[model samples]
Target: MSTLNKVADVVPELLIGAAVDVVVRGSDSFIGDVLGVESRYAQLGWLAAINVVVWIIESASEYAAGVLWRGLAQGIEHDLRVEAYDHAQHLDLGWHETRPQGTTLATLNDDVNQLERLLDVGFPAILQTVLNVVLVGAVFAVASWQLTLYAFLPIPLIVIGSLVFQRRLEPLYDDVRERVADLSGALSANLSGIATIKSFTAEDRERDRIAGFSIAYRQANLTAIRSSAAFVPLVRMAILAGFTCTLLLGGWQTLDGDLELGLYSVLVFMTQRLLWPLTDVAEVLDLYQRGRASTVRILALLAVPVAVPAGTARLDKPVGGRVELRGVRAGYADGPDVLHGIDMVIPAGETHAIVGSTGAGKSSLLRLVLRFDDPRSGEVLLDGTDVRELDWDSLRGSVGYVAQDIYLFSGSIADNIAYGRPDASQADIEAAAEAAAIADFVASLPEGYGTWVGERGVTLSGGQRQRIALARALLRDPALLVLDEATSAVDNETEAAIQSSLRRAGERCTTLVVAHRLSTVRHPHRIWVLDAGRVIEAGTHDELVAQRGSYAALWAVQTGEATA
Candidate 1:
């Protein structure tokens, strides 16, 4: 289609040359000679008919090229965005923690869009420009090779200038892409923390910080723009020199009877068509550089190896829910081990609680059990099978986890509860909500389960979000239920209600709880007290209290038996 359009585009210049032949030479014209016609009127009529056909072909081929190129660009953009996001989703939690969320988003969105722009618009224009130059140059060569020599003299200058500008713009555009990611990161962080900003009355400070990022982005773009802008004027000058050569040299040859007047006219018009498009090289190069920089970033993201690859082993149905950590030592990337050779076990259908101060490796232990990160040494096992050897779906399917920070997608109350089990019935969803001690509150809302929770469940209180997360986890009917500070946000009454619910839940599944409050762990079947990443005490509440160890001292301070 693009080739056809370029062919059609050059026909008008030839028609102008043919029209000149008809008016000047009459029966001796090229069209009349080709058709064996001897009349001037008949020759003019043929020229008019040819003009209409060429115009139709040009318009039709233009339409086809637009549809095909734009469609291809859109399809590729959609596929790349989806693939990048899916890859990011499977990456290890450690990898995700090392980068900012907004930088990843920029690669998936803004960078992908840049490539689309190049394919949709820049690529087609470049293709047609090359075709135009070839077709038009061929005509000039056949008409008069002497004129072609003079007209093509400026070609080298244009090509060299374009190459020079491209090299300079490459680094500038790369800097531009980095600034874009930085600005996106700043905006995303500010928006997510808008509530904190307002509470601390730091809105102006945040605005100034964002302004700094924006300024850097704008300056980076300006630097590239200045370089790209200079390209067009220099190209136009080269174009002007070529046009003048075609006009003056061809005119002198025609006047001296060395060149045909009809051919001379064709050379003048075709020179403009060929050299003028070269001016657009600047704009095309700009798009090319930006897209090139974007492509590098997108490909880099796709090339990152999946640090925690999935295993091939499948778990047996009706898992026993037994979990064990044997001589485990683990930490985040390149950091000291948070879990220092720890050994622990929780039998099937039992409830175990881990109590500790901040940064005591309570959460780190949960991460290993969940396979978010593999332990540096030893093994984490589920039902006597190593977690690293189990397929992700098989291992994760049997486990349910609620983290310290609850995340609820923007949806209805019932939708959030049914998230883990999308095929769950309304009755089953309500039952899980009841088990989480949140059914009554959801029932009191005017919209009931259909209520909109807003982004991150911001419309609900912290306790409500936590309870909804718990309900979602419970709805999975997992054999191993992991709760990390699940009741930390709720009041005493609500905490007691959740504890009662946990007791019922523990009857059929293994439950692991991590808590800072001693009261929350008092009723568990067993409690492990961790101090500075080491387990110092393990027993039931009464047994630990009687031992007068770390758990006893913590309980004494909580119960007001001693001043800490």
Candidate 2:
């Protein structure tokens, strides 16, 4: 369609030239001689009819091209953005931990928009410019190949200059892309931490920090723009040279009776049409370079190997929630092992708690079991099957996990509770909320289950968010229920209620709890005490207290029985 539009666009110039020919030569004009329409008035009328048809074709083709290009741009933008986000979501936690959220977001949003801009306008403009040159040059060649030589003399220089500009602008635009990502990252971090910024009275500091990023981004753009701006003037000079040669040489031929006056006029108008668009090369190159840079980033993100690859094995129905870690050594990228060759097991339907201080690898153990990261050595097994060999849906679907830092989506309380089980009945949602001890609070709200939680449940208290998250997990009715500091945010009363709920829940499923507070894990079937990536003690709470090991020491400190 764009090709058709470009071809149609060149017809009017030919018609104008033919009109001149008819006026100058009458019966000798090519259309008059060939079709035997010798009357000059009739030739003019024929030219007018052809002009209308050409305009209609041009208009229709332009409209079609616009719709097709814009549609293609939109489809590509949507698919690429979704693909990048989907791939990012599946990447291992360790991979995500090393990169900034803002940078990733910039790639997904800003970079994709750049590609859209190129497709929507830049690509069509480039295609039309190339076609105009070829189509007009063909006309010039047929009428006067001698003048064509002069008309196209500067094209090589324009092409060479464009290439040089494209190469120079590539690195500059790449720098611009990086700067934008930095700006996005800083802005995103500041917005998400706006409350912290206010509480710390660091608004000015954050503003200045973002200003710094913005300034860097502006500088990068200016550098690319300065280089890109130089391209047009140089192209214009080349175009001027080409146009001048054609005007002088073609006019000389016409005066010398070696070229037809009509053909000379055609050459003049077509020269401008062809070389003038070359001046727009700068803008097109600017878009192309930016889009190219964005494409590189997008492809790089898409190419990142999934650190935790899914397996082909599916968990059988009636999953036994037996979990075991055998000689498991795990850590983040380039970090010392957080869990060092630890061996442990929780039989199906047993309730176990892992109590450890910060950096003791308690949460790290959970990550391994959940298959967020593969063990550096040995295996994390579920029901005697290595977890790395289990399909993602089967593995994750079977285990319900509530993290230490609770996150609730922007939606109703019921929506959040039923997040893991979206099809869960209202009775089930309410029951799960009731089990997490948040039912009374929901009922107190004017909207009840439909009450909005706001962004990340900002309208709710820490305990409320935690309970809502726990309810979301319980709604899944998972075979293995893992809680990492799940009750840390709650009050003593709420904690007691949640513990009571856990006792009942443990009766039906394998439960693994990680907690800093010794009281939360005291009543579990067994407790494992970790210190420096090693399981230092494991036994019933009373048995550990009787042994007076690391668990006893921490228990003493937490209970205020001793000063630590």
Candidate 3:
């Protein structure tokens, strides 16, 4: 019914178009008779006035419908694109990991545009074509039933042909849409990894990959085009067949005096006016099928279930950031548990670190703390409350996470710093930057805080971006701060600066650090050593190092010892 309301927006145009056909045909018949009569001047004046009035209505209605439909298309496009994006945002990290960014972008942009095109042109064309048939057929039925039969005889064939074309075109259109998504994905990957491609001198390889996707896209479109191209000619032939029958049969009746000349003129004019526009219906139907295919894809994306639903409970007070994981077993889909029966606790305002080798699931533990994914067994708690029972927004608001691979949005430096706290003042922004040891670097830039970071913060070096991300987390002033290899990209001086800042910040909130650089974790209140997804050791840095275990071995490797 909402879709029907959109059709109503163009109803005036449909009505005027049908009315214009009637007026033009009726006036032409009247002109022949008025010229044949004695009072030709008076009749000509009246006919001229009627034609002018109808033309004004036709022109005004066409303009109004065009404007209205475009506005409606833009509004719908905005809503659907936003809704798809918001839904995707709420989905679990695991879900995002399995989906390609380019495919998701194509669904949001290309698919929505397809529907917009249908609204802009296809919907109005269909409505007007329908009005022409029904209204013109009614006018013919009243004048002569035999002529109506001849006029509408080929309509069924046209409809049958349209259906056949639509049926064949649907799968091909679906193929076209899929191929476009594939091409978009390939293009996005190649563009994003252009630096890597150049370093490896693999431009030709990447270009070949993109070319294959492009060729597939072209072939899919060609297949759909081949079928769609056949339709206009078929509709024209159907229109010709109907028009020819009406002309020959009506002309014979008129010459034999079985039908009046004025009626014959009107019938001939209406037949051409009504059925000829059906030729355009082929293009309209093609637009509709393509739009329908795109709609299906968009709806499928919207239908993806949110694996991690948000909780409704709000905290009685602000969270104090005491986090605990109780026998929490979790993993990716169809994979063994990354965190197997892990039981741990971090008291409020404590600083702890987790250090492990590759595939030891160090980062996975932090993800659980953030509730990016729920445990397959047991529960994660925040401040003695199960995280699954806490309001997700409240839980998230009380925690700040800095990932290993920092992603800075395309915006000013101030914008990126204030991303987690949009309403932060300039002083607060500068203070956070200073805390992250990035204030001097920012101030040195000509644009300073106003500097625009290119897409993915390409304007900033890796260490700078990491510092900016830390500043963003600091701006949030969260009760719990999780840093995953936060200083990995920075030089030792910057790392020392960040570590100094963290030492001060850790006194105010719980801090969990996942670091490969042993220097960062050496002073933590406690260190957890992970081996094969299990916590094998937990103690203060000195205790763990003295134990001569996994943590001791890792420290020896980092401290330049010859052997464990």
Q: What CA root-mean-square deviation does each model show from the true structure?
A: 1.2, 1.0, 4.2
Candidate 2 lDDT, tens digit per residue, 233-348?
88888889989999998999899999988888888999999889888889999999999999999999999999899998987889989999999999889888888889999999
Model 2 accuracy (lDDT, Cα): 0.92
Model 1 regions more than 4 Å off: none
The worst-scoring run of ten residues by lDDT in candidate 3 lies at 1-10
The per-residue C-alpha lDDT of model 3 at residue 83 equals 99
Q: Pick the candidate with the highest TM-score.
A: 2
lDDT of each: 0.92, 0.92, 0.85
What local lDDT score does residue 133 receive in model 3, on the 0 to 100 scale? 79
Q: How do the candidates rank by TM-score, highest first?
A: 2, 1, 3
lDDT of 3 by residue, 107-214 (tens): 999999999999988987787778777777876897789999989988898888888888888899999999999998888878888899999999898888889999
TM-score attained by model 3: 0.93
| Candidate 1 vs candidate 3, TM-score winner | 1
Candidate 1 vs candidate 2: which has greater TM-score? Answer: 2
- Measured against the true structure, the TM-scores of the candidates, in listed sequence, are 0.98, 0.99, 0.93
